[model samples]
Target: MPAESRTAFSFNNSINPSTFILIGIPGLEEIHIWISIPLCSMYILTLVGNCTILFIITTEQSFHKPMYLFLSMLSIIDLIASTSTMPKILCLFWFNSREINFDACLVQMFFIHSFSIMESTVLLAMAFDRYIAICNPLRYTSILTNPRIAKIGMIAIIRGSVLMTPCPFLIKRLSYCGTNVISHTYCEHMAIVKIACTDTTINRAYGLFVALVVIGLDVLFITLSYFMIVRTVLSLSSKEARVKAFGTCGSHICVILISYVPALFSFFTHRFGQNVAPQVHIILANIYLFIPPMVNPIVYGVKTKEICHRVLRIFYQKH
Candidate 1:
């Protein structure tokens, strides 16, 4: 009856598991050539930016601090998140290779969601580091040692892997006889699961549960940490000290907003905005997941003065 339903119905019946065609950014097939330019630019920038941050943090002993440790972790997570989807997306756009194997699809979904969760977890660690630095300056160094930060990073990896390990199995159990055509460029869990001919009650339920459990707890802790940081900053005796303390938080605050706001909006849109155009949903999904990775390094580049100074010094010396 409806056009969208009709389109879905056709694709639903076309799946055979030999290969699923990824429809990249629906309704823009004619202009995909134009689209690849911008997308490739972003991928290149993301790689360069995140790698540069990693290089600076690793090589410079001065950056051997808890805050920079979290920053380094964030860069690595961003790299993982982008690599999970962007290469395939770029392939789809550039070579017109829409066919992805079923196992590959499953792998993509796992990495994308897992690294996303890990990134949020890393953010929580960073928030706690800042809270301690600002609110308990006397004990910050004593408490947050290099070993402790490394442990935090290990925990983040474990948390993401363990939480998301069951997800691929959930989808793998489904019978996808109807259609294998994925609407988005990459294999998002919901997008892949939606093609299942069988009842998807379990898949949907488990996904929501994980989202709420993992992201929900991380957000709660981060919010509380910031709340305490703000309280501690405001009570400081010297105006200059208060300003400096808050300034340390400003970059992270911007990063949190950039990462969470779009992601939450995209998540809700997928769940609630069923009537929204499929193209809009796909585009927003890309923005939510990809934009942060592309822009985060840029944000930190401007926000962290030491990073900027070091980068400039290297360039000047090379010249």
Candidate 2:
């Protein structure tokens, strides 16, 4: 019994696992290069799209409102979340490189989880902005000023980090006995924990707590905001005004559903989809997490006239 093996829950009580092996798409090793091609395309698209949105919002005068400010925040989060895991996946798929250092896994888990939580929070903030604009137009400007939006962004980051900080340490405390192999493309919290040869009740409980309490609350508030928005929209006297207001929220609504539906589906499949294959679950989870980074900007660029005009102008000027 060494000093380091004194965890609250220990099974093997042996030495530390120096490295963990990452796995993806079981039984598809031979065609991984082919898989990497499409994945690389998606990753590139995610980066370029999010960066373009950020660029447009930062440089354009008309895009500096609260909605676009939150869009910028989301772009930043999407970039971090997508990049945090994609490079590792590319290596795993293209180069057959699966060995990741213990500390590196911790860092990856931290960034992936933190940004994910932050993105969800930002969506919640965006919902609040929409609610204010539609339901309480007079107070919207005062409530969601640049400074206030900045504070909200900062709070989202801080809250996400503070909650996810403990996850890695919890896994680090456990003794990994044999086969430090994680059955996922990247260092997800539960995927890494499954390799631990110790009682993982607390780890599982904490992860569930964050998912249910922190993220679930965000979903609840977003729903409430939209509910109030619809109520207010219906109350408006002019049909054209109502149509215009709903149209303004159309992109955000689509983005919200796109982000949440897949996420909630993948989450439930992981936890309770008894007959689903692990590969299918992993693919759904990856899509849930990564597609938004690529799709969100496109939705905004197409739905938002100002953003679309600026984007096309930039392209024309470049060409």
Q: Per-residue CA lDDT of candidate 2, range 160-206, in tens? A: 99999999888888878755767788888888777777898999899
Task: State the C-alpha lDDT per candidate.
Answer: 0.86, 0.86
TM-scores for all candidates: the values are 0.94, 0.94
Q: After aligning candidate 2 to the native by TM-score, how far in Å is the CA of 128 from where it should be?
A: 0.5
Report the C-alpha lDDT of model 1 over 101-200, residue by residue, as the tens digit: 7788888888999999889988889899999999888999999998999999999899889988998888877876676678887999889888789888
Off by over 4 Å in 2: 1-15
Q: Which residue ranges in model 1 land beyond 4 Å of their true spot?
A: 1-16
